[model samples]
Structure formats: structure tokens, C-alpha cells
Target: MSIGRTDLNLLKVFEAVYEEHNLLLAGKRLHLTQSAVSHALRRLRELVGDELFMRTGKGMVPTGRATAMAPALRDALRRIEDSLGVEPFSPDSSRRRFVIAANDHVTAVIVAPLSRDLQQAAPGIDLVIRPSTRLDLAEQIDLGRIDLAIGIFSQIPPRLNSRTLMSQGESILMRKGHPAARRKLTLRDLTKYPLVTLSVGGQEEGAVGGFIVERGLARQSEMFDRRALEEALRESKQEPRSRVTVPHSLAIPALLRDTQMLAIVPASLAVALAKSGDLVRRAPPYKAGTETLRAVWHGRDAHDAGHAWLLERVAAAARAAEEALG
Candidate 1:
């Protein structure tokens, strides 16, 4: 059947159910009763000739065909919403919740200041911080699962828009009385200690660990390798020592206290920790090029007033955080 053969309202119900997975929740979101929602789903099934969703133990599960229709349906709905201007976004008056995907370290540095500013400006605004996996950024942004993402992103899908907020180099972090705290961190010194490095799964090529490799200071090491470095007492010519494995940058400061562990982190974060007396920041022994922290959003939201406002605030907060660190 042609697209004209099906009712658009049925597609809306189908899309909501596909996203929420629970009929009751989907119905509540669409302001429809359970029976009405089910009827819409049935109509959709008739039009598509597929059992779009099957009952699962906890909620409905989409069939393969239903899963494939999700993105197109979502995109169409977004376009329709934009065209109708049915609900113009009013940040000061609307109770819209915005979801931002970012790493823990970025959240620690940006969220607090941004939250305070937003609350004072628009008390009704709700902010949700979600964990970001590198692999899901493009998909999440495209599917409207995440409104914006902020971090040192290297791989931005061609369809997305991004702007650099600030650039940062790598630095070493050590606790206040540690031997390395008073000295510069050379490659040899770094290799000598038990290191703690931040890692995120599915990061882009030439991001994160690649910084060290690009500098010729150290080769790319996995989390397990970092752990082996920590356990080895003496370094051998054949087997390189392992360092401590940390997945998030914010954890570095707490781990360095009263231990010989040293961590490499973004200069901005290192400076922030140093100012709080949580850690001492030192230049890395070798030259690691700077990475720019960027604010990214789907191109569809480029002209959106709320999205634009949030981007501006994020940029301002990043600059403030950098200045505070300095």
C-alpha cells in the first residue's frame, strides 16, 4: 500500500509505542487510552501487514520490520511537529526535559554551573544527564534520544553539527605529597609509577589513548594492560609494566590520594582538581597534542531556540571552567 493509504495518526501511536515499549506509557504520552492506543496499533498492523510488536515478559518487543520503521517514523513525526508549529518551545514557560549525553568528567565540570544558571533563568526546565558511549552518539542524536553531547569528540557524523568550546592538552595528576607531585612527569617517570588512565569504550580512532601514541610517548594500551602495569614491581625489557585502569576522568583525583598511582587527564580537569587540593597537576613528560572539547547536536535542532540557548550556555560554562582552572 502507498503512504497515503495509512492514517498519519496511527503512525504516531506506532512510533510512541516503539519508543516507550509499554503501551500504557505510550498511551499516556499520546493522551490516549490503552484501548485507543491498541486500536491504533491494530490499524497500523493492517496497513503494514506485519505484527509490528509482540508481547514480551515486561513490555512489547518490536519485530524486525517494526524496528526498521522506527527511525523513518520518528523523523517524519519531527518534521510534522516542526511544520505545524503546534507547540513552540518556550524555555521560560515550558516544562520540557532536555537530555544531554556526556562523560562523567565533563558532567562534573559543566553540569553544576549550567544547572544553576538554567534554574535561575528557567526554573521549569529539567535537565537529564546520560552516559555517552562513543558508538551511540550519532544514532542517539539522530533518533532524538539525546538532545546534545559535550566532550572531546573526534568522530562527528556528517549529518550532525558541532562547535568547539575549548582545547585541552594532557597533564599528569598526582596527590599532594607524592614523589612525582613535585617533579615534571617524564616518559620514564610515568612508566615507573602505577598509572591510572581514563578510557571509554568505542571511542573514535585517534581519540583518547591515541593521544599518547601520537606523541610517541607510549603505545596504545588497553584497560587490562594498564592493570598489569600496576601489578608489576619491576619493568622488564620484553613486558611493559601495567597501570591502573580507570574508565572516567573524575575518578583520577580520588585514586591518586595516598597511593603511588599517577594519572593522565585533560589539562582542564587536572587544573580543576589541583585548585581543590585534591590533586597536583604537572605537565606530561612528553608532548601530547591538545584535543578540543566540542558541543554537538543534530542538524535538525540548529535553529531551535531552546537548543541554541543551551549550546550558548554550555559554551559559556566551558570557558568559565577553563578560566577558573587557569
Candidate 2:
């Protein structure tokens, strides 16, 4: 296949169809008819000597060849658009949709406030949240499906770029009127009361250096530093009665609403969750060092105006969240 003989428009159609997964929608996006989109796809497939895509009831599924072509193709298109001067992004006037990846806690702590801020400043913009803990997170970012990922990412691939949001230590959260709510959280208290914590993954799932491995990508899974907590426990010679471990941080409020179960969570998240006035936050006796919250995205989008604008807003939100934590 000669690259020079291929129609560049087919690549555009491919990108739109790959993203929308429907020829009609892709055609509408490209301002072409359904038949025209089909024709271009066929020509491109024949030239490249690959089926490229397969039609399914759900939509058009890209073949392995197309999947392999997509990330680089989209990146090239972004570069081309940037070189040709893409339209200026006006959040207030533009109806752009930003897909951000965040964990449930970050969504509540940071993204929730961001939505309210957007309501007044960029009313026309839309936000889509993706779970940052998903196995294919990096792949999704590379495919341009997720514009930004907000969380504690300790290992960022070379292809990706990251910006730190805030650094936070662990805090103990317990319901009001709890046995320990009246006093500072101590290792002895952790040993006495049944503890609840969040764990996305553990050593069984191949975590090293406080990160969990999934789909070849290492992500910070354990919300707090286990080694530090264990070290503190050993130094104090206390065995914590850790009973309930949950996957979602949002469940902590209900879990601790009336019971004596205490949770060790990120201070920033503790601040957000404590807004209900039922949860009390206190410094833990153990020395769990600070964890940096960050936003990660494909390096290709680092310079895109819209993405840059979203980054600015997310940074501001992080700042606001940090301030609120204090």
C-alpha cells in the first residue's frame, strides 16, 4: 500500500467513526452523508489492505489494525489541527464535552465543585467522568476517549504527562458521637474499634512500591501508604482490628453513620466527606506521609487549547479543595 495514494479524508472519517462507532454519526460530524462515509472507509480499507472495522449491533467495532492505527492517527490529526491554528476555545460560548477520568472520591471532592463552578463560568461546557481505577485507563487516554485523569498516579508512562494537584496525608474519619470522636485518633483506638478502609488492589494483585498493576499499567491503588501504617503499628506494638475494606470511598459516610467503625482516608477526601457534618476528621497517630493528587493526560493534548483550559479549571478546583481541607 502506497501512503501517498491514500485519501486523508478517509483517515478523518476513520477517526470520527472510531470515536462515534456509527457511520451516520461520523458522517454528521464530518458533514458528509452516510454513503460517503462508507465509501471512504471502503477505499481506505482497500488501500491499506485491511478490513479496518467490523459492524456490530452495538456499533462499528474497529479491527485490530484500526485499533493500532487510531492513537497515532488521532495524535497526527491533533498536531495538524494545532499547526493550522484550531479555533480558540471559549468555555462560556462553546458546547464542548470534556471526558475526565477520576475515582469516586475525587469526583465527590474535586469534580463536584468543578461542576458548580462550570455552571456559572462555562455553562455551555459538559463534563463526563470516567472511573480512574478502570484497568484500561491509560489505553482510554491514548485513544483520546479520556481527556484527563485525576487521582494519585505514582507511575506516569512516558507517553503521558501529569500535573500535581495537591499533597495530602492520611486522616482518621469517624462518625459523630463515636467512641473515639471525642479524642485524637491513636494506634490503640485503631486496635480497639473495627476499622474500615479503602483498598483498590493489594499484594495479591501484584502491587509493588505502593502501586497496583493492571493491564500492564501501574497505578496507585492503595489510598494510603501501607508500609508507613504498618511501621507505625509495629513501633507502637498494636494490632489494628481491620475488619471491613471497601472499594468505594463514598460508602464511608453510611458505613460510619451510626457505628464505631473508623476509616483512614486521604485528608483532602476526608475534608470533602466531612461536609455532611456527621463525620469527624482527626489526625492519625501513625506517620502516613503525604500523597500527591494529580491529573494525567496524553502528551498529545498537553498543548490543545480546550484541554489546557480544562487543566486550568481542574488545577483551580484542586487548589480550592486543598484550601477547604485546611
Model number with the top TM-score: 2
lDDT of 1 by residue, 219-262 (tens): 22222233333334234333323466667777777788789887
TM-score of each: 0.74, 0.90
Clashes of each: 7, 0
For model 2, how does the per-residue alpha-carbon lDDT over 268-302 read when each residue is reduced to its tens digit? 88988887898899998877888899898888987
Candidate 2 structure lDDT: 0.85
In model 1, residue pairs whose N, Cα or C atoms come closer than 3 Å (at least 3 residues apart or on different chains), thus clashing, are: 185-285, 226-243, 228-242, 229-241, 229-242, 229-243, 230-242
Pairs of residues clashing in candidate 2? none
TM-score of 1: 0.74
Q: Model 1 misses residue 52 by how many Å? A: 3.2
